[model samples]
Target: MTELDVKDWLVVESLQSGIPLTDRPYAVLAEGIGMDEGEFIRRTADLEARGIIRRMGLRIRHHQAGVKGNIMVVWRVPEARIEEVGQLLAKQSSISHCYERPMHPELPYNVYSMVHAPDPEAARVEVIRLAELTGIDDYKMLTTVRELKKSTPVYQRPEE
Candidate 1:
């Protein structure tokens, strides 16, 4: 992979959560990094084209935005049908995340998804609908009781 420049990394860090909503956000970002607007926009586009950055956009915490509950849902899907079932679950807007995890030999579920909603009951309804749609008769729903830590920075410096 191509290494990112100091300006590119600075852009990434500055855009972690607060991306300014302006006509020329990159220009604004460039000013912050002591570069001219044109250079900032050009380099940012280059970084995106190289896949150094996935996307630059808003990061919203649904819970803080009045989504008061989140449900961790697990489905006992057959290995052969894991992908199909996961795709089905992922299609639901209510499901923000979905993945297939290794099942505990003693446990009854394997496919997992996280659904965010305004309340626990709303989340339950979504899970039930998903199960019905996927023909998954066996599943478990675990509502989050508390969040220990929610936000973390992605970039880390290499150790000396």
Candidate 2:
């Protein structure tokens, strides 16, 4: 959106999904856009340098990949200790994603974390270990019940 011309915007659109899964993916992508492969790669690099693209990564379906357990652990951390405890949770190898959030009046969870394990019992054990590591007793482990859709976002320009 930031000064990207029609062709560049189209390039970004193509990139939103991913390069083709062929042997020469970039070549296929460039060919699809009627562009030279080298130029296409250069433009992508330039776009990244300009911060137009934050990350170009794959989203794996962990369950399909034989990773069974997925637990979301929320911590009711005190304001004075949230940062210290949050860092400790984030450093855990079993933990995938962790962040701090606004504590609800009734629910009162300030720190959140995502842990992945092969089984529910393993996830529970890991969550318990994380609790002992952080010394934050008040926590909950919520298991994933369903996965509706797992696709990378493709941005749509809103009508003026």
- Top candidate by lDDT: 2
- Identify the leading candidate in terms of TM-score: 2
Which tens-of-lDDT digit does each residue in 1-160 have in candidate 2?
A: 4777666776787787676678888788888879998988888888888998887777677778977888999999989998899888778888889999888888789899999888889989988888888889998877778878776667754444
Task: List the lowest-lDDT window of 10 residues for candidate 1.
Answer: 151-160
Residue 108 CA displacement from its true place in model 2, Å = 1.0
Against the unseen true structure, what C-alpha lDDT does each candidate score?
A: 0.79, 0.83
Local error of candidate 2 at residue 71 (angstroms): 0.2
lDDT of 2 at 6: 66
TM-score of each: 0.79, 0.85
TM-score of 1: 0.79
Q: Candidate 2: TM-score?
A: 0.85
Error of 1 at 149 (Å): 1.0
